[model samples]
Target: MRHFIARGAGLLALVALAGTASAETVLGTPLAPPALNADVTGAVAKHFTDAGGLVFKDLKPSKARGGKGYCGKVATAADAPFVPFQVILEAGAAPSVLLLSDADGASPAISEENATLLLKNAGCLE
Candidate 1:
C-alpha cells in the first residue's frame, strides 16, 4: 500500500511539472496584443503615425478595413456629463469593438457601444 501511494505521489508531481513546463512568460518585454483598449490602441496608432512623420492630432479615419471600423477626433459638449474623447470602432463577426483616447488629457479609456460615449462624456477618455 505504501509503495502504491509513493508511486502515485511521484506521478502526480511529474504531471504537475509537465503542465507547468508548457507555460512561458516574458519579463520586462513589451509585446502588443492583437486587440487593445483605448489607451493601447491609440498608442499603437501613434506609433505608426510618428513613424510615418505624421502628426497624431492631425490623423483622420480612413475607412473601415475588413472587420475594422474607424473614428476621428472628438467633439465636446459643455453641458454634458462625460469627457471629451476620440475613438475608433472595429465591427467584426466576433465582438464590436471601440477604442477611445481621452481628449480631456486625463486618461485613455476603452469601451463598447455607448459605454465609450459615456466615458467620453465623462471626460475620462483623453
Candidate 2:
C-alpha cells in the first residue's frame, strides 16, 4: 500500500508539471532583452529595404501570447508619424519581427498572415 501511494504521488506530480509546461510559451518562457539598436535596425533593413530615415522609439518590455520581448514604435524622424512594432528575441532562436502598419494606410512590411498572427500574439487583437 505504501509503495502504491508513493507511485501515485509521483504520477500526480508529473501530470501537474506537464500541465504547466503546456501553458508555457514555446517561443521562450521568458524572452531575452533584444539588442535594441542592432535588432531593430536589422529588422527594418530586412523588412523595409528601400525605406530610410526610420528610427525605433518607445521600446518597453512586453508580455503577450507570443511570449515576452519588447514592444515599440518606428518613425521616420523624431516627430514623424510612426507605426507599432513587436520584437521577440530568444536565445538560439531567430528573432521575430512584426511591423504592424505603414502609418499611411499602406500594406504591411510582412505578409498579411504573418502580420495577423503577430498582432494576435502581441495582444493587439482578440
Candidate 3:
C-alpha cells in the first residue's frame, strides 16, 4: 500500500511538471528586431493608422542585438488607455507589437480580429 501511494504521488508530480513545460512552450519567448527597414516601418505605421485610427508620433527605431530586424517605440496619446508600444520586426516572421500596460503588457488588449487585420495590413500575416 505504501509503494502504491508513493508511485501515485510520483506520477502526479510528473504530470504537473509536464503541464508546466507545455505552458511555458505555449507562451514563447519574445522576439526583438535587429535592424531597421523602411518597408517595415511604413507598414507598422500604416497598420496603426488604418486599424486603430491612432497616429504614432515621435517614433524612434533602433537595431536589436544579433541582427534580428528592427525595434521601435511610438509615443502614446495622452488620452489613450495603454502606454506607448514596442514593435518588433523580423525578416520572415510576423511583426510583434506589444502594448505596455500596468496590468500585463505581454497580453495585448486588442481584439483577435483587429490584431489579425493589423498584422495583415502590416504585411506580417498572410
Among these predictions, the greatest TM-score belongs to 2
Q: Which ten residues in a row have the lowest lDDT in candidate 2?
A: 14-23
**All candidates: CA RMSD in angstroms?**
22.5, 17.4, 18.7
The per-model lDDT (C-alpha) reads 0.28, 0.45, 0.33
| lDDT (tens digit, per residue) of candidate 3 on 12-121 | 22111111111111012223241243343443443332323333333344333333323333333435442333355455854544332211222334444544443333
Q: Candidates ranked by TM-score, best first? A: 2, 3, 1
Q: Whose TM-score is higher: candidate 1's or candidate 3's?
A: 3
TM per prediction: 0.18, 0.47, 0.34
The total of clashing pairs for model 1 equals 11
Clashes of each: 11, 0, 3
> In model 1, which range of ten residues has the least summed lDDT?
14-23
Point out where model 2 deviates above 4 Å: 1-36, 65-68, 102-126
**By lDDT, who's the top model here?**
2
- Give candidate 3's whole-model lDDT: 0.33
In model 1, the Cα lDDT at residue 35 comes to 38
lDDT tens readout by residue for model 1, 1-126: 222222221222211112111112112322234233333233333322122221122123323333132233321222323212223333332222222332222222222434444433433333
lDDT of 2 by residue, 42-118 (tens): 54444553345555655555454334356666665657676666665556755555555532224323355555555
